[model samples]
Target: MKFYGIVVFLAFAAFAQGVPHNGRTKRSISDNLETLVESIQALASEVNEDLGIPAFDPFTDDSVAISINQTLAKLEGELTDLNIDGLSDFSIDTLKFTLIGLKFTFAFTWPNITFSTGYSIDGTVASILPIYGDGKASGEITNLAVSGTVAISVKNSYLYLKSMSSAVSLDDLDIQLSGLLNNDDASALIAAVISDTVPQILVDFQDVISDTVNTAVTEYVDDYLGSMTLAELLALIGS
Candidate 1:
């Protein structure tokens, strides 16, 4: 995400400075634009290395609780936590994200982001009656993918990435349970419980997730851009 913002900043700086002031300048503007695109791609790759963003990495969320009420199941509990490795399957190709708005003219338009992966989680229910008492259920949601458009804007010379809209889609959700609720059909009941509850859970925490993402982006961008100066930036472009 930090690299994503820098890609725009670098392109803006290059375009702003590379614009010809006099009729006599021999360099073509297209050449500079072309070079800017290449530099952004190269720099983004290096930043990924510096950030140690592996091709496949795990993402975890530990503090998520949701309340549920449905005809099939009525439950109150937290998602407890989740861990899913091999996130590389969800990784959007750099080109897909970069090429969409790499042109200098499209700097103000936000780019699209997409991700796909499978994740497993534990659910701790304090009260889910009829079917069982206090217990925990484990499950995995496979073929999950999310896509959205992010809006990036500058205010007071500081850049901000805000999630304007997003959508989540998944293929299969399977759950297995234990602790007083264990049965031959435990998985189906657990699945029904989660299916009814998870969507509302996401809806409830949407703003929190958006803020967290924005805050992380702000921190990373501020650190990455803070030490850079106008002259150094120009040097980077020219070099």
Candidate 2:
């Protein structure tokens, strides 16, 4: 029952830290982003839990839509310009990130075989690349350890930083719980928690969880902490 365990997956961990504006430095973007990461991680788990769909219940279709809408709203509000660029360095190509998007919507319209629904921001962040924006005055995130990509574009004063991740895996979680319960009843107990509703759930909630996490990560890299420093940037960040 490794289903309850943390599955390893590739992430867009690219980010920036020290930010310089008009030759002066500000806060560490990486540190602030870490906070966002924490929130996304927790939320992803929650979404996975809510994917309780029973084929017998076609009504689950609408509920699924409502859930996605709710999640999108939460993500959009979370990063209302929280200056993600300030926390990023972009010093290298394929920058890895833990946080940073757009009005990306994805749907899995498979017939009688899949029920995956998702959306993406935009851009790619690698797990190894490090980079910073051009200009000598620009500061960098110190000790900025990352794991994925943080890609963004500037349009109409707004920074659309989106994170993309794939390469994922699902595992068994019954290992840890093995001893918690007696030998006779332990296996069944673990199976019940990790098991899904027959054909209703397949490949687990990995995609849904990944998308939710991606949204949060994208928001983290699109911070507006430094926006207060400039009116033009502020307006952009607010958007």
Tell me, by TM-score, which candidate is best: 1
Q: For candidate 1, which ten residues in a row score worst on lDDT?
A: 102-111
Candidate 2 structure quality by residue, lDDT tens digits, 48-92:
323331111111122111122332122111111111122111122
Model 2, CA-based lDDT? 0.28
User: Quick one: best lDDT, which candidate?
Assistant: 1
Off by over 4 Å in 1: 1-56, 59-82, 91-134, 180-188, 192-239
Show the lowest summed lDDT stretch of 10 residues, model 2: 1-10
Candidate 1 structure lDDT: 0.43
Please identify model 2 stretches exceeding 4 Å from their true place. 1-149, 170-188, 191-204, 224-239
Q: Residue-wise lDDT of candidate 1 within 138-235, one digit each (tens)? A: 55666555545544444455434433344454555555554435453664666677756765655566555445445545565455445555344334
Overall lDDT per candidate, in order of appearance? 0.43, 0.28
